[model samples]
Target: MIASVTNAATLESAFNAFNEQSALLESSYRELQQQVASLTARLDEAQSARHRELLAKERLSEQLANTLEALPGAVVVLDCHGVISECNAEAARLLNQPLLDRPWSEVAKREFAPVDNADGELQLHDGRVLSLQRRRLGRDLGEILLLTDVSETRRMTEMLARQQRLSAIGEMTARLAHQIRTPLASALLYASQMSPGDCSDASPGGKVVARLRELDRMVADMLQFASGSNQDDEGIDVALLLADVAETGSLPMEAASRVAVNIADSNLRIAGNRGALKGALLNLLDNALIASGDEGRVDLGAWRDADRICLTVSDNGCGIPENELGRVFEPFFTTRPQGTGLGLAVVRSVVDAHQGEVVLESGSQGTTVSLCLPAAAIPSAQRAPERGFCHA
Candidate 1:
C-alpha cells in the first residue's frame, strides 16, 4: 500500500510542471503577436509617405510640362544623352515638326549645326535667322535651347543700311553744291552786268545765269543741312539749347509771326556735343513750325525726372501718316517739298551718342518729339569726345 501511494505522488508532481510550462508558452505567443502588429503599422505608415512623395513628384512634372508648352519662344529640352526629351509649340513651328522626341539631328536635320559656341546667331537652311541661347538644365542634365526669331531684326537692319546710303549721297550732294556755288555766283553776277549789245540775239547767257543762281541757293541750303558740323561736345543747358535752336533755325518773324517759343526754368542739363544737340533740337523745332505753317503754335519745354531729363518740342501742325511714322528716324527720309531728309536722322544720331533716345509721336492733330537724356553729373568732369551715335 505504501509503494502505491509514492508512485501516485510522483505522477502528480510531473503533471503540475507540465501545466506550468504550457501556460508560459501561451503568454510568449501573445507577446509575439503584439510585436508583429506594431511592426506592421510602422511599415504601412512608411508606405503611405512614399506614395504621397511620388504623387507630388508627378504633379511637379506635369506643371513643368505645361509651362514649357506655353512659352512664346521656341524651347527644346534635352536628356543627358543629348537626345531631345520635349519641345514647345514654338519649337515645333520652328522645326516644322508636329512632335519631337528623336535625336536633334533627326528632328532639326536641316537646322542643326555643330554647336560651336555656347550661344550664337545662326541662319537656317530654310532662310530663317535666329538667335540661339543655351543654358544647362541641371548639374548633370543636358542643355536647354532657346531660339529667338531675328528675321524682322535683319529686315530693319537692311532698311537702316539703305537709309544710311541715301544720307551719304545727300551729304555728297551738299558738298558738291558748296564747291560750285562761288563760281556759279560769280558767273551770274558777270552775266547780269553784261548788256544785250555784248550778247547774241538769243540772250541765252542771261537765262543760263538765272538758272545757275537758283541752283546756287538750293546747294547752299543742302550743305547747311548735310554738313552736320555744328555738333561740338560741350555741356548744354536744356532750356538754353531749345531757346538757341528756336532763335537760329526758326522761320522769319514775318513768315510765322504767330509762332510762340516757350522755355521752362527747370535748369535741366545735358552732357553732349553742343552742336549735335542744338542741331537736333533745331530740326525738331523746324519740323514743328513747318507742320503748323503760319498762325500755328510750337511749344518747347523741359523737365527733370529721377536721374534723367526730358526735353519736348511740340507743334500744332499737320501730323504724319501712320505708316511713315516708323521710318521718320531713318536717314534721308522726308515729306517736305524742299527737305534734304536728314533732319530727324541727324537728331537721332546725336541723341544716341549721348546715350539717349528720341521718341516721335505724330497723328492727324500734330507731332511731338521727346528727347530723353541721362543727366550730367552734378560736378562735371572733362572727357574726350564721343563717337557719332548709331541707333538701331
Candidate 2:
C-alpha cells in the first residue's frame, strides 16, 4: 500500500511539470511567429523600395540616351584601346559613316584633313570645318570627343578680316591718289605735247604717250577700287546691262564674233548700282574674251535661279592655272606681265557690296565664272524694254 501511494505522488508531480513546460513552449512559439511576420513585412517593403529604385534608374538611363541623341554636336566615346566604343547620331552624320568599333586614328586619317597651323581644327572632305574638343572620361576609361561645325563661323571671320584689310587699303589709297594724280596729269600733258608729230605706237614720243596713258588708266582703276561700290538701290535691266557691257568691252572683231549671250528671261532685273554692275560685267567679259582668244568661243548666260539671278561667263580656251586660281582675286596678284591685277579684285569688291557671291571653276578644257545676286522685282508702272537673246 505504501509503495503504490509513492508512485502516484511522483506521477502527479511529473504531470504538473509537463503542463507548465507545455504552456511555456506555446507562448514561445507565438512570439517566434510574431518575429517571423515582422521580418516578412520588412522584406516586402525592402523589395518594393528596390523595385522603385530600379525603375527610377532605368528611366534616368533612357533620359540620358535621348539627350545624347538630341544633341546637335557630335559626341564620340573611345575605348582605352582608342577605338570608337559609342557615338551619337550626330557623330555618325558628321563623320559620314558608322563609327562603332573603328579605330579613331583610321577614321581620322580617312575622313579628316588637318588644318594647317590650327590645332584641334579639322576639315572634312566635304569642306566642313569642325572644331574638336576632347575630355578624359576617367582613369583607365577612355576619352570623349565633341565636334562642332565651325565652317560658317570661320568663313565669316575670314570675310570680316578681309573687309578690314580692304578698308585700311582704301584709306591709304585715298591719300596716295591725291598725291599721285597731279604729277601723273602733268606728265601726261607734257608727253602729249612732245608727241604732237609722230603718234605711232613704234615711235619714241608715241611710246611715251602710250605709257603715260596706261599709267593714267591704272591710277584711275586704283581710285575706283578704293572707292568701292556705292549703295545704290536702282533697278538694273539685265538685257540693257548686257548690251551696254558688250558695247563697252570693245573686243576685237575676231573675238567679238565668238561671243554668245543667252538670256533665259529678258525681263530679269537686279537691284544694285548700275554703273558698278556694268563695270564688273565688262571686266569679266574682257577677261573671258582674252581667255577664249580669237579662235575659241565665250558664252555669257543670265537667268533667274530660285530667288537669285545667275550669271555665268565661260570660255573655251586655256584655263587659269590651278595653283594661281586661289590668288586670282587678290589685289596686286597676277600672272600676266602687264596685268593691273586689280580687275578681279574690283569685281569681288563690287559683288560683295551688292551682297552677291562669285565662284570660279576651271579645268583643262576651259574656265567659267559664276555670279549670284538676289533678284529684284520690276515696278508695276515701269515696263522693261523688249529685247531678245542674241549671239555676237
Candidate 3:
C-alpha cells in the first residue's frame, strides 16, 4: 500500500505541472490574438486614409484643371518630356487647334517657336503676330505657356523707329540748309540781277541760274523747318502753349468747335526750345484738327508727375488702323490724299532733340499723342527763373 501511494503522488505532481503549462500556452494565444486584432485595425485605418488621400487628390486635380482652363491667356501644361498634356481656350485659339493630348512638337511645327517667355513677339503662318511667354513650375512639373497678341505693340515700335529715322533726316536737312544756303542765295541774287534776256535763250548759265534760284528757295524753307536754334530755350508755362495752339488753330472759334485745351497747373513749366516746341505742337494740332474734319473735337492737355512732364494732344479723328499705325511715322508715308507725312516726323525730331519721348495711342474713337519730357535740372548755384510766356 505504501508503494502505491508514492507512485500516485508522483503522478499527481506531473499532472499539475502539465496543467500549468497548458494554461500558460492558452494565455499566450489570447494575447497573440489581441495583438493580431490591433495590427489588423491599424492596417485598415492606413488603407482608409490612403483611399481618402487619393480621392482628395482627384478632386484637387479636377479643380486645378478647371482653373487652368479658365485662364485668359493661353495656358499649356507640358510634361517632363516636353509633350503638351493640356491646353486652355486661349491656347487653342492661338495654336488654331484644340490640342488636348497633342505633342508640343506638333504645335511648334505650326510656326509657334518655343520662347523662354510669352513676352516675345511671334509671327504666325496666317500673318498674325503674337507674344509668347513660358513659366517653368519645377524640374518635374514642366512649363506653362502664356500668349498675348503683340501686333499693336509691334506696330507702335515700328512707328517710333520710323519717326526716329525721320528726325535724323530732318537734322541732316537742317545742316544741309546752312551749308548750301549762302552759296545758293548769292547765285540767285546775282542771277536775278541779270534779266533772262542777258543770257542766250538756251545758255547753260541761264539754266544753271534758274536752277540755283529754285535751290535757294528750297534751302530757305528747309532752314525754317529744320533749325531749332532760332527757338528760345527757356522755361515756359504750359497753359500759354495750349491756349496759343487752340486760338491759332481756331479750334475754339470754329462753328463745330469740339476742341478743348486743358492745363494741369498754371505753374507747370518746361525748359525747352520754345520755338521748336511750338512748331511741333502746332504741327500735331494741325493734324488733329484736320483729322477731326469739320465736326470732331480736339483736346490739348498738360500734366506733371514726379520729375516728368507730359503734354497730350488728342483728337476725335479717323483712327489709325492696327496695321497702318506702324508706318504712319515713316518718312513720306501718308494715308491721306494730300498728307505731307512729314508733320509727325518733324514733331518727333523736335521731341528727341529735347531728350523727350513721343507715344501714340489710337483706337476706334480717336488718336492721342503724348509727349514725355524730363524735368530740367536746377542749377546748383542758381535758382530756376520763373516760367516765361510764349505766343504758342
Candidate 4:
C-alpha cells in the first residue's frame, strides 16, 4: 500500500513539471508571432512606396517624350556612328525623307550664303534655309540635332537690306550724275574741235574718238555695277576661265606671262556670269599692273583649299599705305587721279553674289588680294572663278 502511494506522488510531480514547460513554450511562440507580423507590415509599406516611385518615373518619361515631339525645331537623334536613329515630324519635313538608319550625308548640308558673320544657316536643295545646332548625348550614346527653319527670317533681312541699299544707291546715283556731266561736257568740247569740217588746234581726231570711247567705258561700268550679272546661270571650267582671264586681264602677254598660275585640279568649275567675272578680274589685274609699275612681276594663282577655291593676286610693288588700306574697298574712294574708284568695289559685289569673301593684305614688301570662293555644287575635285587668276 505504501509503495503504491509513493508511485502516485512521483507521477503527479512529473505532470506538474510538464505543465510548467508547456506554459514557457506558449509564451515564446506568442513573441515569435508578434515579430513576424511587424516584419510583414514593414514589407507592405516598402512595396507601396516602390510602386508609387515607378508610376512617377513613367509619368516623367511620358512628359519628356511629348515635349520633344511638340517642339517647333526638328529633333534628330543620331547613333554613335552619326546615323539617324530617331527624328521628329519637323525633321522629316525638312529633310523631305525618312531619315532613320541613314547616314548624315544623306541630309542636305548646303549652307545658306551668310550676309554677315553672325548669321548661321543651311540651305536645302529646294532653296529653303534652316538654322542648326547639336547636343551631345551625356554618356556618348549619340547626338541630338536641332534644326529650325530660318528662311523667312533671312528673306525679311535681305529685303530690308535691299531697301537700304536702294536708298544709298539713289544718293550715289545723284552724285554720279554730276560726275557724268563734267566728263560729257569735256568730251563734247573735244569732239566739236575735232569734227571733220571744223578742226581746230593740233588735237588729233583720234583724241576725240578716245574720249568718246572713255565715256562709253564709263557707261558700261556703271551699267554693270547697277545690274550685277545679267544672268548667273552658266557653268564655266576653272582652267578655261583662267585662260580667258589671261587674255582679257589688261596686262600685255609678256607682263601676263610673269603671272604664275598654280592649280592642281583641272576639272574644277564654277557657275556664274562669265563676262562680268572677266571684267571684274581685268580691273584687278590692271590695278596690280599699275602698282607694279613696269618692272616687278605679279603672281597670280588659284588652288583648292578644303571646300573653297583660293584665287590670289600678289604684286611686288610699293604697297598701299597702311592708313589708306581700309578705304580700298569703299566705293568712290581712290588714290589715282584718273581712277573712278569702282574697280575693287565691283570685285567685291561680284564675289558677294557668288557667296565668297575678298581679303586684302598689304605691307611695305607687297600687296596680296585673296578671293575665297565656295566650291561649286560639283564634287570635291572642286571650285571657283576670280578676276585676278590666270592660266599659262
Candidate 5:
C-alpha cells in the first residue's frame, strides 16, 4: 500500500503541471488574436490614407491642365527633334496657323523667316509683332515656347517717342523765340523813329511806318507764343498783309528803285496771325533781296491753287548748289558766314504748324521758292478786327 500511494502522488504532480501548461497556452492564443486584430486595423487606416492621397493628386492634375488651357499667352511643347508635341489654343491664334506636330524649323521658316535665335522678336507679314521665348524642359524632354503679342505695345512706344520729340522741339523753339525777340523789338522801335506819323488810309511814308509798327507787333506776338499763350488765332487779309510786308521788307526807296513787287492786292482772308505772316513774308523778301545782287530783279506772287494758297518768290541770282539744296531747311545750315541759318528752319516750322508745304527749285540762273498753305484749318476763334493798332 505505501508503494501505490507514492506512485499516485507522482502522477498527481504531473497532471497539475500539465493543467498549468494548457492554461498558459490558452492565454498566449488570446494575446496573439488581439495583436492580429490591431495589425488589421492599422492596415485598413493606411489603405484609406493612400486612397485619399490618390484623389488629391488627380484633382491637382486636372486643375493644372485647366489653368494651362485658359492661358492667353501661347504655350508650346517641343520634342527632342525640335518637333512640336503639343500647343495651346493661344499658340494657334498667335501664329495664325495650326502648330501641333510641326517642326520648329518649318514653323520658323513660315512665320519668322529671319529668326536666328530661340528667344527673339518676330515681325509677321501682316505687321503683327511677337516676343518669343523658350524654356528647356529637361535633357530628354526638349523645350517649351512662349509667345506674347507685342504689336500694339510696340506701336504705342513709337508714338510716345514721337510725342516726346515734338515736346522737346516745342520747348527749344520757345527758348529760341524768347532770346531773339528782344533784339528784334529793339531794332523795330529804332526804325519807327524815322517814320514818325501814321495816316488813316496810310501815307506812302505813313504806310512804311505802319509796316514798321507791324514789326513791333510781331515781336509781341512771338513773345506771347514763347510765354505759352496762343496768339494770332484770327483770319488775315491776304492783300493788305502782303502790301505791308512788301513795303517794309524792301530796300530803301533810293536803293529799291529796281525792285518790283508783283503780289496781288486781293482782300481775300485766310486763317493766320497777321504779325506772324508778316514776319514770314519779310524773311522771304529779305532772302530774295540778298540773293538778287545789286539792281537784280525779284518777283513775288501769291494766289490760290487747288485747295491751297500758293505764294512764290523768285530771285535772279546765283543759285544754290544742287547737292546742298536738301539741307537748306535744316537748322544752322548756311553758306553765308553772316547768315543765322535759322531763317529757312523757322519758315519750315511755321509752315508745318499750319499743315502747309514748301518747295524749292534752283538752277544755275535763279532760285524759286514756293509756299503752299491749306485753305482750311482755320482757328476756332472768331475773326480778328482789321489790322489797326496791334497791341493788347
Candidate 6:
C-alpha cells in the first residue's frame, strides 16, 4: 500500500510542471503580437512623412522655374564647359539667335560686336545696346549670364550730359559779355568823337568806328544767346530790314559786290525782336560771305511760303562738308581757325526763341540755309517804332 501512494505523488508532480510551462508559452506569444502591431504603425507614419517631404520639394522646384521665366532681363545658364545650355525667352529675343547648346564664345563672336572704348557692353547687328554681367554658379557647376538692354538709358545719359554742358556755357557767356561791354562802348565813343575830316564814311576813322560797332553787336548777340531770348517782339518790315542790312555793309569792302538781295514782296512782315533779327541775318550774311570768299557770290533772299516767311542765305563757295552740317548749330564747334563757333549757334537760339525752323542743305554744289518764320500781319502804319537796327 506504501509503494502505491509514492507512485501517485510522483504522477501529480509531473502534471503540475507540464501545466506551468503551457501558461508561460501563452504569455510570450501575446507579448510578441503587441510588438509586431507597434512596428507596423511606425512604418506607415515614416512612409507618409517621406511622401509629404517629396511634395514640398516638387513645389519649390516649380516656383523657381516660374520666377526664372518671368524675369524681364535676359538670363542664360551655361554648362561647366562654357556652352549655352538654357535661356529664357527674353534671352532669345535680345540675342535674336538660336542659343541652345551653342558655345558661348561662338555666340559672342557671331551675334555681338564690341563697342568702342566700352567694357562689359556689346552692340547687336540691329544697333541695340546690351550690358552684360556673368556670375559663376560654382567651381564645378557652370555660370549664369545677365543681359539688360541699355540703349534708351545710354541715349538719355548722353542728352543730359549735353544739356549740362550747355548750361555751363551759358553761365560763362554771361560773364564774358559783362566783361567785354564796358571797354567796347568806351572805344566806340572815342571813335565817334574823331575830327570831322577823319570821320567821313570813306576815312580810316569811320572804318574803325564801324568795326567797333560790329564788335558791340557781337557782344550783344552773345548776351542775347546766353539770356535765351530777345525778350522784345515787334512788327518788322522785311524790305526795310533788308535795306538796312545792305546799308550796314557787313560784307568786307572788297567783297561788297558779291552779295545780291532778292525780296519776293516788300510788304511781307514778321513779328520779332528787331535787333535780334538784324543780328541773326547779318551773322548769316557774314558766314555766307566768308564761305563765298572774295570772288564767290552770296544771295540773301526772302519770300512768303504758305503761312511762313522763308529767309535764305546761299553761297557759291566750297560748301560745308556734308559730315559737318549736322553739328553746325552745336555750341563751340567750328572748322575755321579763327572761328568763335557761336555764329550758327546764336542763329539757332534766335530762331528757337522766335518759334521758327532752320534747315541747312549742302553738297559739292553749294550750301543753302533757310529760316522759316511764321508770317505776321502788316501793321497799320508803315513801320512799328522800335529799337534801332543791331548794326545801324
Per-model TM values vs. the true structure: 0.45, 0.68, 0.43, 0.44, 0.43, 0.68
Which parts of model 3 are misplaced by more than 4 Å?
A: 1-232, 251-256, 376-392
Tens-place lDDT per residue, model 6, 251-323, is 3566567777777567778888877777788888888877887788877778889989988888887888877
lDDT of 4 at 44: 93
lDDT of 6: 0.80
- Candidate 5, residue 127: lDDT: 61
Q: Per-residue lDDT for 89-199 in model 2, tens only? A: 999998968579999998999898665844668899888899899999999899999999999999899888877876887888788988988998998789878867765
Mind sharing the TM-score for model 2? 0.68
* Candidate achieving higher TM-score, 3 or 6: 6
In angstroms, how far off is 154's CA in candidate 3?
17
250-319: candidate 4 lDDT, tens digit per residue? 3344465555565566666667777776666666766787788777766666677788876677888889
In candidate 6, how many Å is residue 302 off? 1.9
lDDT of each: 0.71, 0.83, 0.73, 0.73, 0.69, 0.80
The digit string of per-residue lDDT tens for model 1 on 168-256 reads 87768765775687788788788867765543324666556546644654454455445544445566766567767666654344433
Query: Which window of 10 residues has the lowest lDDT sum in candidate 3?
Result: 383-392
Number of the predicted model whose lDDT against the real structure is largest: 2
Deviation of model 4 at 189, angstroms: 22
lDDT by residue for model 3 (10-108), tens: 999999999999999999999999999999999999999999999999999999888877776677789877888877777877787757677777777
* Total residue pair clashes for candidate 5: 0
